[model samples]
Target: MNKEFDDNGAAEFEKLLQGVKPLAQDKLHFRPPVKSRKQIIENSHRQTAEVVFSDIYQPLLPSEGPMRWNREDVDPVEVKRLRRGDYVPEYLLDLHGMRQTEAKREISALIQACVRQNSPCCCIMHGHGTGILKQQLPIWLAQHPDVKAFHKANKEWGGDAALLVLVDVAEPTQKR
Candidate 1:
């Protein structure tokens, strides 16, 4: 009777192990983390925050000359250098068919990029289209705190259709 019981148990165990296949290991695949994509989205959202180009204080810009401006603390020679094409732009943003809203967001992102990359200068190309962007771009650049100075581009840098902007990328020195 003991021999018969052992034989029955062994047969049952063998039946349970039928048709089990081993896992395949032929190819390697890489999947980037979903968190990486989420971070990218979050970063873009932060950069696209509403940058209010205030109308309460539009400085009377000359209609017939090269547009230029700078923060009160900035040196005038910075603007002169920009005019002479002494400072080459590290990045260039071209606004051709973009509407006002898109253009504004792009400008904001561009400034953020410049600040992040420690880029000292950038150029904005607002072509002579309907004159909408051309008129509004200087005001926007002037209002941005990061914009230390800007001037109409030199002939080699798109001339009257573009503006060279100086970004304040220097880390503030802490005092003891």
Candidate 2:
């Protein structure tokens, strides 16, 4: 009877094994925690295969430069007229030591606030970095949609290290 019982158990185990199917290759594959790993691997593999990078990847940057404006972009000699301290900045935000991302967001908020408050002009003291502001700030400023016009501040203001931005004032009727 014991032998017969063992034989039946072996038969049942064999049947269970027969019913199990292996997982699909796609399901069995593990994903790495790093997102860029896949891209990096593909890039490397293509390079080893003698495939040109252009075939697998597109350029990330545009060939064109930022918009350009001459003195004529604004009324002639109006900038000199602003020297009488007529351009009062209601809000002055100094991003002297903020991190790159923080500075960018703060600048955006400041521009919006200036507009909301109907402030005609504002001063941003980005300071003279060895070149940090020179590189990052300009990119942020150019990408900023709300910025009407900005230029290097006059020497009396802060010279090349700072910017004098003319903000669009909210219409009086719209200011609630």
Candidate 3:
């Protein structure tokens, strides 16, 4: 059978692609999805597959003391590594003048972004201006499940005014 140009088929193809556009490079995922489409939900307060941060119960944290926390399963050495400035922060968030509510949301977004980008380590500079955000940062971070560990930054990364956090993400599988 010899092929011939079918005008109707060509018109249908054009119609299908008339409004289609390429996905943004930044939005593209290079790795396979961790969860099925049904399990993933995207919203202002929800980004990660099944993680949410709550601000209701504030934990006991020293107002001016060095901030540090880690999940029970996480090793203490991880916090030591953060204090040593071993893992350079892949993302930095400066919450200078925002209120507690706004600061919380920004932190949530920061963690979500870090996980999506496969950046296990990041920094949050809450500043020592009013000491409001500074005091609240660790409380909020401790509530998130993805926050594996965090410690007060060393002098190089801002010292007493910032925190270095380690987010939980799957390690890249090596190809044999």
Candidate 4:
């Protein structure tokens, strides 16, 4: 390789570059920084009312009766169908013997996997013992971005002891 460039070569390069101009900037163009997952979740929590299990649960409700919820965007007919157990769940998660923390983690994973797989419906069998899981399940489901709606399973499907969740195939943008 050549040890060095000739001085004339350097001067020629500089002269050729001097005529070139830098790219123009658009002063009005602006974009905010993308939020991290934790930040997005924290923001979502702040925007929605916190789910308190005690406030939401009704232990006295009969096991044979149906309990249901639907987002504003969900159709009324769809909720009716869910209440009737018309739609079969494609995924099932049984949190029978699991602790609260473990159940929570499992539910989150299950819902995410369902969404990724584009499965629209899932069932969770969380027995009606002290009604702890039954009570807390709604709160967790409500917080989940992918969950569009949820209803208590029908008599044949575990009744009050289980939940049939309707998951959105697409990523959820706004809070429910």
* TM-score of each candidate structure, all chains considered together: 0.69, 0.51, 0.67, 0.59
**CA error at residue 32 for candidate 4, angstroms:** 32
In candidate 4, position 119 carries an lDDT of 84
lDDT of 3: 0.80
Provide the clash count, candidate 2: 0
lDDT of 2 by residue, 46-99 (tens): 443332111223223223542121133456354444444456666777888887
Pairs that clash in candidate 4 = none
Q: Quote the RMSD, in angstroms, for model 1.
A: 7.3
| Order of the predicted models by TM-score, top scorer first | 1, 3, 4, 2
Query: After superposing candidate 2, which stretches have Cα over 4 Å from the reference?
Result: 1-86, 174-176
Clashes in each model (backbone N, CA, C under 3 Å)?
Answer: 0, 0, 0, 0
What is the lDDT of every predicted structure here?
0.82, 0.60, 0.80, 0.75
- Cα error of candidate 4 at position 38, Å: 20
Expressed as tens digits, the lDDT of each residue in 130-171 for candidate 4 is 888887787677666677888888877788799999988874
Superposed Cα deviation of residue 58, candidate 4 (Å): 13
Model 3: CA > 4 A from native:
1-42, 46-51, 60-65, 173-176
Q: What TM-score does model 2 achieve against the real structure?
A: 0.51
Model 1 scores worst on lDDT over the 10 consecutive residues at 48-57
